[model samples]
Target chain A: MPVPNRPDRLFRHARSEAIFIASFWLACTVYCCAYCYMYGYITPSRPLTERDVKPIWGVPSWVFWGVFVPWLVCGIVNVVFSAWFVADDDLGEERAAPIADPGGTEADVA
Target chain B: MRDIWRDVLSTGGTRAESAVIFAAEVGSEPKALVALVVFTIASLGLGVAANRFVGREAGFLKKYFLGNRSLGAFAVALTAAVMSGGTFLGFPAFVYAYGWITALWIGSYMVAPLTVLGVMGKRIGRMARRTGAITLPDLFRERFGSPTLGLITSVLVMFFLTCNLIPQFKAGGVIMKKVLPAAATDWATSPPSDDLDIKVDLDTGYMIGLTIFTATVTAYTAYGGFLAAVWTDVFQSVVMAIGVLILLPLSLWSAGGLAAATARGVHDAGIGYAFGPGAGRSFHPITLAVSFFFMWAITSMGQPSTLVRLMAFRDTRTLRYSMIYLTIYNFIIYVPLILIFIAARSVVPGLSKPDEAMPSLVIKLANPYVAGLIMAAPYGAVMSTVSGFLLIIASGLTRDVYQRFLRPHASEKEIALMGHVATVGVGLVVALVALRPPEFLQLIIIFSSAGMAAAFLVPALMGVYWRRATAAGAIAASLAGSGVVIALYALGMLPIEGTIAARLLPANPDIGPASSFRPYYLLGFDPCVWGLASSLVAGIAVSLFTKPPDEARLSLVFDDGPAVEPKFDPPKREVESRGSEEPEAPAEPSATERRNE
Candidate 1:
């Protein structure tokens, strides 16, 4: 009942993982870039003054929110997903074969 | 203190000019040089030990190139997330000049580990084991049964990887030059007297350093192989972390607390230091922010080096643990660098060269002994990166080109010999070229990294996931991707909007020309994005029009055949059959073969 010419369950796990990660990355990208450009970016016509940017724990408020906070959050997301959500597929054999002679060319036995 | 921002505005000079000026202040104390020497010796010992471990193992090519596919979680994470000298040297230079805007420039690294591993780790590992692939090109060639495709990949890998090494070599020389005796570097620091009969001043220190750096890296890489590269990467990763972590506190203390430093930095460089489109309009326009986000995450996913590490891990557990460790590693290294360098801006106000920022600040704040170890961080990174790249080039020539085509019946010893020879040969060539390095070494590094990502990312993704992918499609994808990026670089050499070539790619609009050569960021997006887009379009479109790949091959990769023994024991005939350069005959009674039976 399986669809023909599609990746098996093992490969599908990797594909799904890739899709999920990509979506998370897209979200982070949007938040960081949008926030930075909106608040941090300065121009002549729409200029920002020193008062407009405030220090938060030594970093500019814009950077604290736009980059630092998201970076911390993304790091957490990576940890959670990798530890819990990511799939664990059978990675096949541990060792191919032992070298019969340590002195000899190992590829000869392959 | 020199006001770098005001200089850029008034003199119409680029930040790069300031970089050249900083190269003059090169000499360091004896303790730092001694520390660098000790680090080098330890790395060399590790390399020899790795070689012995590899020699005692099975399958010289497999053990040497792929470490017999037995790396653990920590080794995988460190090697995969290995940072080049740019992370310490060139990147900090940008931060010193551009300020907090650089945070966004490198922001996407937060997800770099996830993207690099999550995208294709399991699938690529599965395919490599199933097909008995030792190298990246080997994976492609074996999967599609196309020697031509394999050969093209080999050439491209060699070309880009070789280009990638030049800057690293130069960085190694530059760092070594800094640690040389002041007497030797007198020419660099002081002008020759008019009373002298002949004003003969050459950078003797740099030459000596270049020779020493090149010999050390090449010898270890050629002597050992992949195992050496990975082990050294782990060691270097720890050293780099310690170096930066130590520098952070010292720098903050020197600048009188983080808040005061941040305030002073903004006051010194103007509000631009703490804002986007930073001082002198560098990293300008919103599109660039978007472009850099793609450049870091997506482009990194496509790197062959990352792919090679993915292929070598033990299992899913290794993958899972590596992702976890790398998240911690990334946060520890990258986040601190931004703050450390920002604090450094306040501590050392008028640095001649931004590229020299890390070393300059380290010496100024830390004592002679501590400064030496901090310097080791960057120097060790250079050695690890160079050695890693050398092995990749060696693998390309040895497995993909020589054994596969030139001498298919070569003995195991001959194959082993070729790997060593190729590594040394490539190392010497890159070192020789690096002696007279190009003006803009960092830009060249960026181009090569982007070029590799553009060339390999799409074809590789399609190859792993798409059962319908044909050899032609992959070949087209690679060529189109490489072509678009190369063409744009060539176009950038032209005078855009009737301006001179030198001014074409300024990082800051106010600065006349920062670099001699720059990539044409079309529509404010990097060439890598355009190249990647083209490759994806070409790969999918070409495959749709072409004949589907051989049904048997598709089943081998995509189907869930009757669970047989692990693909550990490949028969002798399959190994011999690689020499034929033909569509491989069924090596095992695999899914397709068994179904027919």
Candidate 2:
């Protein structure tokens, strides 16, 4: 009794969503790895505050690679996701439901 | 963590070295003061002018609360200027004091635009439009048909957001103290030494700044509402950017380039501030770093003031443009800031108080007029944030409480007047509390905002995308999440000196056993992780067992099936398919209408 929609034909919504989430988190994991290996693994496991690390360019090495650059990449990826991937199904004309009745009984008010 | 840093930052530094060489105060202050006065007046003038354009007939509450749901990308972008003030000031201060690991705490801000708008804006904007929900709690009430849930949300957001506002007031005071040190009261005359046992006099500049900030924000927002607030934000954003652009190159130039500055300034090299083992040697513990990383990356979406912008955009394209523009803006403002603060370590070395790093650097490097321009930027940031929150509190008071509970049949005239009255009242309360701030400005900010995010994150997202999410689930999730956060905050506030737990934290004699902020990483984890966990579990568990929302309402919010969220964790209910694909039994008429009738 369910109504078929155009989006379902392109791919399973669940499957597409699953792949996207997996890939995004995977990239995040990759970024974390980049931070650890390149920046030095003195994080959760090592817990060492190596006071002798110098900057690559103007920024510290781990910060440039681990924090700043990775953040840039993540931001760009999120921007792309925002533009192309987001759908307006709930917001579109099909679902432009009217506001709840203003004069509704008191129970609905508070 | 809160009490440790709070006491240390506010009282003095671990090693508050006197300034090696204090720069003579710049003489161009009069010119800069003129510019600041003019700019402030112009902003107020603009606020009053915008009021004429708002048609009062469309229900002033609606027009005021949501700009009549007609915000463009530019308005949305300016509304984000709050990131400029306290963060801009506090971030650099932290960097100057702690060194490299501070990068991780603020570095997470780069993703803020992406999470705030790109992810949450378009969807929530559309949802708010469709459902006629203005405030965040209204979305919950209508979407889930739970007024009780709505009321609880209002109380929770109001509590934490008020806590969040304290920092902005303090930030305003910080800026004032830096620019007009003369304005500071008698107590600030002989500045206190970097001793934990001694209490410093309240800065005269701060008192003046807070008064000015509170008065201006309350005035414009009270008169013009959301649009005025957004418009002022736009102006503030421009001022902030100009200040940073001017200050960035100069600060870098003063520091003798990044390489020299880093080498000369960081005596211990590598900053010793990584998030793993041996961090006692550095500025960070790995546990804290990881917590901060996740916190900033995700929490921006949960802020009610920021999220409300989603409810007002003109259309989907506006949301898109706002995202794109915000990303670019963040880069423009934040990148240089990172460089500027690092350079500050050299330009103005050995300050007893690091929070004065930026303001002090500007006075030393730039002319008085330029300093004023730069000083105004953070003030802009704080004003935008404070005004936005003031409006939110006002809207909450008038619509959620008065209109909903006390005056269900109140006339429009009463509603409009109440809106203005509530804004002033809220502003006054916040300013009064700020007169005697409890801890470091940044510490209070982190506590309040993080708590808000934890409390609302699960419930807001679930209400939007999940079909099976029930009112009971939402109520349970919100209560549980906030409960954990408050409990953790309370525990952190406890005086735990002489206890075995004290071994976990760094030693500071000033706080004695009264600081319960130790034990931040019990079992090697943070409370935020636990708060989030409890929220999700409670929401998912209660909703699955309880009756789902009406099939109609569910279909409306997550139409055409294939919800974006559940794709991560595939829904167990096959009955919840979208667009009638293998539909389950037709749902009973939900309380949406029956309860109304």
Candidate 3:
């Protein structure tokens, strides 16, 4: 097949897909925090302090928290999406190359 | 002075003889040329592999430069580590010459892993995917919505990359001359003699080595582009890690074991405390802390070479892994260097230059072949860094300058070609500049890093998280900060003095010597401090006065939507038809969106 003709369309499609993936990641992260406690894996255990202030001066704490919550959610959603994506690959006709040879010895097997 | 010269002349008829004896006794050059040749070929192979994997015909020039954002953890870590050659070579020398205090501050560069992890890497990856902005300048223009700002940013990047590149060339030349003295003599047109009596001119050696190194790097980088650069960096990083780790134990053994080496160094150089200037009074804990803080802040947040690695990562997950790997790698690398330096000081007292200490120890103390390989460590550092700089400069020119301005409609293939051409052009310019060595590494580091930190750091950080940051503010801040730093330093307002200033810039001294303030000596004063102060003020002041872009428009710049979910909606057919492809169907709408409707 010829390469996608419309660059902007491909980009927009990619972007929209990315957002969905990110949102799903965030949802999963929130779920994990509430139930699984995976937050410990990613963040060092330290009390939040003034020194952790955003590098930009004058940014409010609430604003940072606002960004933080969404960001955390996105991270979780991305993880779940990645797992599903990989699984989808297994279900598809295009088999992944062998893992032993990382240098692309495997090709798409139909 | 006369006696020293007389002793030198009596010892050897010419500088070449002294170099040869020193090189042979120390064993600076040997079959290491084989290793260098092998590494260069491997770099080419990696480049070809990356290009094919990414799909060469992909149309966006940004994807070509950025490897379509499909890079993994290993590639990202290697790229970041290699780009930090400044920290690697410059740190050890600074410690040795200025004292352990200087080294400690420099050593704190390890913080780079955590810093980039917390901020730039994840944000940039998310932003790139969201906006489809291929290069840094593209991101800037898209976020700020101003072409002029993009152009200015591009110029500043080029300047910083050039300055950073010069040192790598110089270091490479230094290694090559040490590794292959006979070849160096032949290249320099010196007469052959048993003693190898040739004049040792630091300037001449630096130039010759730089020319050869630049030529080799330029050839591979120009052809392979980022693919060639990153893969080569990965290999170099591995070699450097192995070489440094191995050299630590071997050199200690050669010096008759770690205990003897430590005792000797202490007897001669003293146990150089991390807080105090061990041999000299150069170390003051407070001053060291200040320098460390500045270096950590500026290098982690501002260095363009490091920032480019963030742009190369495939996703946020890759960034996390890269950061973890880099953090571990840096710690492992630092411990060995510290031990090695301490050992060297004990054994080899009164070394001429700090940069020479590592080489001297390796050659004089270690076995010949091992010494040769160990000395090659710095060569790897230099090449990796230089290639990284070459890639950034080429991308800045091709993607940011040419495609953005000169030829906006150029296809991906054309853009990739231009990128390769730009890499060669940049290498040649840097090679010419490297012909002249500067007075000190500190001068180059402060001048280049401070200039970049002033111009880009505040704007980049604030622009990403703050919706209020305006295009006019970014432009004003960058221009003002860069202009003032350059003008002041050029005028001798900085701590730099006579010969160094003359070498860096040919103008007559505009300010008196007393006006120059060394950052180490001054309290509450340093380039990073002043540069950050000025840029922050300019950026915020300009931003407040200007109206923020409308929310709808601003959302495009600061939205974290794409980063949150994989919302793969096939574009409508009409949108696809405009470009040439048929659009796919839209995926599910979000809960928030459905609620709003």
DockQ values of all predictions: 0.38, 0.27, 0.02
> What is candidate 3's lDDT per residue for B1-597, written digit by digit as tens?
222222222211121112222333334434566555565567666766766666644444544566666678888876776433333344454444443333334343344554544355555554554444566776676567666787888888887767666655654655555555555546565433221222224444545655677777887777666766777778767876776787777656655654454345435554332223334433323333444445463445666756666666766556656756776677667656655665566566677655456556665666666655544444555566677678878878876667655765565567667877888988888777665544333244456767887888777766665668888899888877776667655554343455665466544322111112222222324445667778889999898899664332244334422212211222222221122332132132322334457
Q: Which candidate is the best by DockQ?
A: 1
lDDT of 1 by residue, B1-597 (tens): 123322321211222222222223334657767877887897788789888876464777888888878889999888777664456665677678778888888898899889888788898888877766788887887666566887898899888887778766765766676677767666655443211111112356666677888888888888878888888889878877888888888887888876776667678778777787876555545777787788878888888888898889889889999998988998999899989988888888776556668778877887778776766665677788888889989999888778766776578899889989998898888878876655444444556777888888988999898888888899999999989898777766555655564465453232212443555767667788899999999988998999766554555566665222222212333322212223323223333233447
Candidate 1 residue pairs in backbone clash: none
TM-score of candidate 3 against the unseen true structure:
0.68
Candidate 3, Cα interface RMSD: 18.9
Misplaced by over 4 Å in model 3 are A1-110, B1-28, B82-89, B97-103, B170-211, B251-266, B270-278, B432-442, B491-524, B560-597
Error of 2 at B382 (Å): 2.2
Query: TM-score per candidate, in order?
Result: 0.85, 0.79, 0.68
Model 1, which residues run further than 4 Å from truth?
Answer: A1-6, A94-109, B1-28, B177-207, B438-442, B496-513, B562-597
How well docked is model 2, in DockQ terms? 0.27
Ranking by DockQ: 1, 2, 3
Against the true structure, whose TM-score is highest? 1
